[model samples]
Target: MADDSDLEKTEPASGRRLEQAREEGQVPQSRELATFILLIVGVTALYVLGRWGGHRLMHMLRTGLSFERAQAFDATGMIIALYDVAMEGLMTVAPLLIALVMATLVAPFVMGGWVFSTNILRFDLSRLNPMQGLGRMFSTHGLAELVKASLKAAVVGGVGTWVVWRERDHLFGLMLQPLEASMDEFASLVLFATLLIISSLALLAAIDVPYQLWEYHRKLRMSKEELRQESKEQEGDPQIKARIRAAQREMSRKRMMAQVPKADVVVTNPTHYAVALKYDPEKSGAPVVVAKGMDIMAQSIRELAKEHGVPILEAPPLARALYANCELDQQIPAALYTVVAEVMAWVFQLNHWIAEGGLPPEQPGSLAVPPGLDPAAGDPEAAR
Candidate 1:
């Protein structure tokens, strides 16, 4: 049995899926993972550099503050102050935030490439009905949204638990340390924790990017109905193509019939084959095959020849040879020149004897050649 999903064709998401995901809160989670990774790497590098610089400065400040001289205490005052410490912290951390913002801006391209289709933005008036919209809101996609939310919660909870467990000892140790020392240690620990979290989120994003791309391509696959529609748009209807072919054949038949009147003689396989030949003394020494056909086209050619009063001779071998070897408006082969010349000579003699009021000469044998004609002289057309 076919599954229900298989029975109904799956339509593409048409950009709407991304928009829907945004409305359902998935977009932020997706971006968060990418941003988190960038933030972690940036902060980690900055923290190490800042700590090294701050440590040296703090040591100098302490040594200077230890002196009883008024000038030394004044010189060290700003470096050891809480406000200055806070400002330094901001300077060190700002790059991490900037990196996170940059990653967020680039995340969509890394994950989905540059698809700028506006298909999802169009709204149907019918869908504006409150009841229909509400129904769709609570549909199968709504269930998917719930599942995604649950998965996100689980991931965050699991990671949070692990972080807490790993940092428990250091966190507890912070309470026993002096105020300034504890603050310094707390800042470093917080930066490290942030880095670890960002790394985990980035890894998750890397896996998801490929999955999203594959899913997008799968959604774009054409359904059977869509393929059918596209084919119709490209090729038109089969019935129309057949009608056009029929019209073209009719036009060709008329043109071939028109050429038959100009032909000198018609050769036929009695009923099945017909070929019309034409010869011009100045233009062609050998006869040219004007038209030839078999079956219905043959019948049409014979009808046209009778209408034009052209002589039709029953010659099976000649008709078959002309039909098989000759194309319209092409001169006959040199090998058949003797046989064709004899036939044409007979035709001319019959016409001449009829005009002069005498009986025509008898039909000649295939081996007979006219006087003054050389069998090996080659066709006059070939000489030209």
Candidate 2:
């Protein structure tokens, strides 16, 4: 019972599942629909061509039966008559044959579009396994097929018997009537039976179409675990992806540290943030940020600056603003021109005083950093 439940297809198929099934050439097709179409086409073709065919058939019979004096003893004459009879028979049924062939060719495409695959034609050795074949024959699907076939056979037989009983008088009188009249009545009876059978088949086809579609979808249903596995396969494992991201950040941090010693000065938020800037009048008009970091990385940048003898200035607002707005290797914003120029002048003056071995000009007392440029709001020193 547990095995049976496990085999049951409960969940709807995903788009990938449906596509895979279609590639394998497993698609919904109603055999009853094809049968109905072929029957209707055959009956209709006969109805349209019956009169013309009857005339030709009669002419052939007459020629084949007629005796000529010149051909009375000629064996070649008999051969000629036979050839004429064969040609007339071929012409007589040509339209019906063509109609049946066309119906057979077209019926499947109307259900599942045009899908031709060599996969289905390939022979598998497993198909010859006696136990498996027997199991399949007695399977639920196989039993359902057997039931459907039986019902169809019964319906067709019943209709045929009823039609024949109603036309019994015509059949019995065929021998008494002229050949042409008998043939006409026989044709009419056969056409009537065909129409009845086709109508019944159409009804069966209507029921079978939806059933086949349902069965097709059921066969393709996937379990929850299967869906999860497929999704993981497509997107990759999340843990591995997170590790990759961490490794990338580590490499970027190392590169940022490498550029810190090259910067002319380091701006800091005391202990939290650090931004390194480099200025060269010959190369660029404005100072460019060479590196920036927060917390642990900020500490590393400050240590590298001190070790390399680079100046470190405590400017919380400038440090935070540069870290927030400027990427490494990018120029600072134009709005910070005045404040940054003030800081640079102070650094240059201090450098000149130390180089000349004497007191130099007094540096600017305070920089006028922009109001909203501060990352930390309500800092009086940043705004001033």
In TM-score terms, which candidate is top? 2
Per-candidate count of clashing residue pairs (backbone under 3 Å) = 0, 0
lDDT of each: 0.67, 0.83
lDDT of each residue in 1-384, candidate 1, tens digit only:
223554454665434445654454333234445555566556755675665655655654565345455644575564566455566656655666676677666656654433444544656786789987887678654564565556556666776677679888988999999856876887777666666556666666676556555554454445567666655666876788899999998887778778898887888876677899988989987899888888788888898899987878777666766776678888887777878887788778866876896777776455333333332234443222
| Candidate 1, poorest ten consecutive residues by summed lDDT | 375-384
TM-scores of the models, in the order given: 0.59, 0.80
- Cα displacement (angstroms), candidate 1, residue 104, comes to 6.4
Candidate 2: the clashing residue pairs are none
Error of 2 at 364 (Å): 6.7
